[model samples]
Target: MPGFPRRLTSRAAAGLALLPALTILLVAHLGSTSWTIWISLTSSRMLPNSNFVGLRQYETLLNNDRWLVSAQNLAVFGTLMVVGSLLVGLLLAIAIDQRLRVENTLRSIFLYPFSMSFVVTGLAWQWMLNPTHGIQKLVRGWGFETFQFDWIVRQETVIYTLVFAGIWHAAGLVMAIMLAGLRGIDEEIWKASRVDGIPAWRTYVSIVIPMLGASFATAGILLSASVVRLYDLAVAMTNGGPGLASEVPAKFVMDHLFERGNLGLAAAAATSMLVTVVSIAAPLLYARSRARTAETRR
Candidate 1:
């Protein structure tokens, strides 16, 4: 009976400790979501209005070119960012997992970018990618006379610059995740593969990679969320410049909300982004849940 009381006390204390976090999530997330939905239905502009405009905001949001461009940009940017980051990160992880001579130093160098703020990363890249004073200039000064790598200032290529930065920043994070996954893998499998005269690459492609399904999922989901909420990086790097070339959903919503003073439209844009992200993420989340359940049963 005395031990039971102690256990109860510990449980109670743990619940109390979590109370604040739960409260914040409920109030901040749920409450804001409700408010956004309500605003989207109204004719709010410059300030909140309860004009009850029905689906007028949604209609306008769907029809707007800026929103459409933002959506398209998101597709390209999100895809490239996720895929490139995964590939680079996986490669880095594999390389480091090889028990290199400078393991710790190399790992820290790779991971250094992930620890920096996106704004900082974007700003740094922006300078480096600038034509007159950055990469191009540096290259030209080295006697090439016409070496140009100014993707940041080009309408057709500005979004790709974002992708480049996104991959560079996120690859380290993916590497960390993959490294953990690789490390957890049973060494016996590697020995067995080698004994069977299987190539290392083939072993990774067929066996080890499949085992790291969870790592891939985690990296993808993380990158997906970052892609959706990709405001700070765009702001710092390109400011959605080159005539709406690198515009993304988050930036579109923010521009409408603050600059254009169209609260209802902004809410609609925000809600649309939320729906798109949920549509993409729900299946992934469900699959991951099912896999976890199967793992537990096994």
Candidate 2:
């Protein structure tokens, strides 16, 4: 018999290597998602039942006040968290990159929060923001009788507290991304800009930002995914308290799944979220594909 061709042997080895990953992906991720979609169409109770209910679950979910509020909260939280984390993180990265003293120490200090479980950090934030025990009480003890930082207890502003802690936890990741991008910049660009008498701010705004597009894209995508799946921090900190002002979509789905025992509704909410994500992402993806095609043609 003729020996196997080298290319055929290489292909067979590659296929073998991919088999485990493909199996896991098919069983765990794709299989679960398909199950979710199917269950959404069924009248599943506490556990998944086989009774088909058509689009009734979707209709019920659409009519749910709590689900609607959760979606709204998610929108607000996602917007604020993404924008705030990116801006602050970029600034922090730039400052640290300036050859400052104790750069590693400062970097570690900022990144430490990311390593912590939200259970610990969120409780700490809750304590710090508590009206009777936290910043307000400390300030009152300092002789200022009217210093009020009680937004944490208010229905209107409690979501902002989530944004604050979310930013604290997330900014480090963004900073790391930006720092990597900044380090990859050609040193000669800085030298040339300096010799041209361009201000540091101008150079960063016009030159550095444009070149760091890949880094920003990476950070933005990561942050957006986190925003969509926000639950742990909210649970640990506010528990969707102050009249559901801090509720988010992930929490809504989880609540319906486990707490409310409405798997059908839960699946409906999850499906809605998936639709929203696709709606937003589709245009961006199309634009990217077009850009890549144009670049190739050029």
lDDT for each residue of candidate 1 in 165-231, tens digit (9 for 90 to 100): 9999999999999999999999999999999999999999999999998899889889988988999
Q: What is the C-alpha lDDT of each candidate?
A: 0.94, 0.91
Q: Kindly list the per-residue Cα lDDT of model 2 for residues 173-244, writing each as its tens digit.
A: 899999999999999999999999999999999999899988888999998988898898889999999888
Clashing pairs in 1: none
Please give me the total number of clashing residue pairs in predicted model 1. 0
Instruction: At residue 121, give the lDDT of candidate 2.
Output: 76
Name the candidate that leads on lDDT: 1
Q: How many clashes in candidate 2?
A: 0
RMSD of each: 1.8, 1.9
Model 1 Cα RMSD, 1 decimal? 1.8
List ranges where model 2 is wrong by over 4 Å: 1-13, 296-298
Error of 1 at 186 (Å): 1.3
